[model samples]
Target: MDDLALSVRTARPEDAADLARIYIESWQDTYAGVISHTLLGAMSPRTHTTRWQATIRTMEKHSGTVLVAEDARFGAVGLCSLGKARDGGCGYDGEVYTLYVDPAFLGRGAGRALLTGAFEAFKDRKLRSCLIWAHAQNNACFFYEAMGGRRVATRTTRLLGELTPEIGFGWKRLAARKPARPMQSRSDQS
Candidate 1:
């Protein structure tokens, strides 16, 4: 990850397809054994694209945010959607609705970059604390823990028809970050 260069940006409507692909691929990779193959196979890229496009628009219209992570050569590798807390009684000012990295790009720092971007957006919105709910069985929980989140709660929700359990990870405070300075290449310095 040290050598990988990644950038996070606000997602636009044009990124819907890329996000859709990432969503499907990541879901398949992450939930294969836990979720039924039939259910996973039912995921539709076209439908996801439409939903994501509308979602991006709505997020922009509202105060929420959608973020995309890109590599210099691999294009869009990950996405994160976040906004005000939706579920009541969470005691969190902000919530990360979804965070997924393309299967091929996992462990390459895309997730890290996107989470960092989400926190920055939180600060801009004056959201001082954050919460993320992930499937109880998903490995993403480990990643969230590595990112300084504390396990605060758990609950069950419906996914398709099955009752799915989730773990809530909370961050009591977010550190303010300064704007990054652009790097100058040696060739440009000459």
Candidate 2:
């Protein structure tokens, strides 16, 4: 964290609105030119708030997790949602469905903290390997690459009637990390 004083914690239901706002904001900042302007224009915090509320509750039943990264100076700067891998072909045990740092907090180590938190969440579920998908044209790929991710696969996903190219980054073996909360063992959680 390098003096960032960032902390990661499981998200609560009340956080949906804020998470939604950040999600939309981050998307607007990162995907403006990458995705269709019409699609982005249609995104609203109201719909996402409901979506995030359901996601937070549904993940509990599915062994998935939503973690928020908070800095001492800024409340909730970033978040990550991850769980068991969805595609069997990927051969990864865990996958990150969302990982974004608010644009205002982009360069201050929030993204790195979020990735580290994702690994920790995966460890909690006994997952040893992980993968994350990013838009092929998105600049976050370099951040993932710098964080030790390898470009292993590519695919196109249909989003808002457009075929959007994406790249999948993977980690075959994740190094162990210090527990987010010291009171208990992560292995005990699974």
Candidate 3:
């Protein structure tokens, strides 16, 4: 898996459908046991595509970026959305809003590549630190821990009538950290 070739680049409007597929698939794969079945069943890729398309259209070039990772055989296997911290009180300068990889591509480098790409983007914006949130019960939460993130906070949020506990992981000195792969320029597309 370490030798697999993967590419990461800025996501465009044309990539919405693929991104939505990856997003919903990854969510279903990761949150099946941790989240309510009713809520998971309610996720609509069509609705998400519209939201994603709107996001791409409204993003300020320097403020945030959405990057997609593609395998040589599979296109748009993973994605990551990054930007300013949603809550200014979090003490982190930037946030990884989301990161998801197709279930088939898990354990490969897609997730790492997307994450590395996001960090590079944060560094490009001169951000010093970043944070990401994941459901505490999600098995993939260990991926964050393995990447050197330290648990900084935790909160319970309501989702589909159920309270879900989430853990926040933070990484400081991002500019000093090396990316897992060389991040492609904004002009690069999968």
Candidate 4:
């Protein structure tokens, strides 16, 4: 998809609306059938605008980065957030706070590219490891595994008054690893 011409850069305050749209669309698409529709509905634009606005407006004090992926053809298609672990329990540990790509961009390498950008940001700060949490029932579990993340733990919690389970993945020197082989190629026999 080289012809797609995607670009990843830090998000600006002006991007709040686009980022919020992507978050809602991606979450709804990715969490369908996994998270209760009621819960998702409760967390949609009307309920999440304030939180998303604050996220886009407030800059983290630590070595953190938020990136948005755009394409001339697709506009703001994906976004990711990475930062130091909040509690300092894992010294110098970085975290992939959020990573989401437009459903239309799925299978086009947008998610992988966004994650690569996040890793590079962490590496620039000299972080040795990174952590990411994914919903256990979400298909992204396989994607995280393919990215070389090892499952470290799982936790269940009540969100929006419904039980949800999240799986944690860890990666060391994540930025240093080569990108995974693409699922399709020009010579694919299929």
Candidate 5:
């Protein structure tokens, strides 16, 4: 599958529905035990679609961006959002607001490719650093760590009658550095 073709591009308004589907699927699968069942159950496909459409519209209105990863077979398999960090009170210089890969594509390199694309976008904007947040129970924390992110802070809150803790990871020069070695490559995976 080394020759399997895939592309990464800036998300378009037309891609919102597909992006949302992947987002919801990934979230439900990855966050099932970590988030409240009530919250999870409440997030229907319509909710994700509406939210993604609105976000895409707003990003188009402004200068922010969303990105999508597409494979020849799976169409859009991953998505991510990037914008100025100040939009939220989290206070990072820049933020990766969303990053989700289809559950089927999880072990592949689609997530890394999507993130590398985001880093290029941030670099083009001259941003110096960026932040990503993941729930403590999500295994993505380790992936971020492997990608050179440093744990900067931890946040705790109650969701769905349970205590959920989130960890924040920061990449000081998300756009400027190169990986020391090539990440593993997979063909036709995403």
Candidate 6:
């Protein structure tokens, strides 16, 4: 659907459920073959709901920010989390912990809105640079590259008892991010 009636705003604890659904579904779709099947299959919306709730409630205390992309027709369709870098050696002072968009909205503007909003948040926080890690095998690595992010490092992390390679993408200038674009408009719906 073009003419996207979308808005980006701070995430609320009440968004836990919708965020959890998006997280679970997006993980399943994006990491099926990249991550262990056992790990991907074990993801639960209920568990993620609790995680999202705690993350939202304690974000301010941690100087973290969460942003959601809401569409008039789809409610909360995308989300992003930004905060101080978790890895001390990442060289970036800020990090995007998570960014996910509903599969139905993937080709739309939700993902870009969430990411750009996160960059804006980082700049607002006076963070020098920002980093995000993705499974080395995930195609989203290309997305990060397309967004002016450079691969700064690589690391291995244990997930579901399997060691997986993760690549860190960094943006040295958060303020350099381009303005987000709206979803493409169409005259007909498929």
Say which prediction, candidate 1 or candidate 5, comes out ahead on lDDT. 1
Tens digits of per-residue lDDT for model 5, 1-190: 3422456798877888898789878878988867766787777887778888889879744547899988776689899898777535255667888899999777667777777888888777767688887888789999889778899878886655677888888887665444332333353235
lDDT of 1 by residue, 110-160 (tens): 787788899999999888999999999999999999888999999999876
Tell me the lDDT of candidate 2. 0.83
User: How accurate locally, in lDDT, is each candidate?
Assistant: 0.86, 0.83, 0.81, 0.75, 0.77, 0.83
Q: Could you tally the backbone clashes for each prediction?
A: 0, 0, 0, 0, 0, 0
Which residues of candidate 2, in runs, are more than 4 Å off?
1-4, 176-190
Worst-scoring 10-residue span by lDDT in model 6: 181-190
Best by TM-score: 1
Q: Write candidate 6's Cα lDDT for 64-101 as tens digits.
A: 88899998766899889989999693688999999999
- Candidate 1 backbone collisions, by pair: none
lDDT per residue, candidate 3, 50-168, as tens digits? Answer: 98998877765648889988866667888889888886728999999889989987876677787778888888888879999888888658988878788999999865567899899
Measured against the true structure, the TM-scores of the candidates, in listed sequence, are 0.90, 0.88, 0.87, 0.82, 0.83, 0.89
Estimate, for each residue in 50-97, the C-alpha lDDT of model 4 and write its tens digit. Answer: 666667656455678779988766788889988886555243388888
- Model 6 stretches with alpha carbons more than 4 Å out: 1-3, 183-190
Candidate 1: list runs displaced more than 4 Å: 176-190
Could you tell which candidate, 3 or 6, scores higher by TM-score?
6
- Model 1, global lDDT: 0.86
Candidate 2 lDDT tens digits, 1-190: 3344577789999989889989999988987877788889889889999999999999967778898888666678888899888978389999999998888877766677778888887888899999999889889999889788999999999755778999999999987545333322333345
Candidate 5 regions with alpha-carbon error over 4 angstroms: 1-4, 87-91, 157-163, 176-190
lDDT of 5 at 82: 87
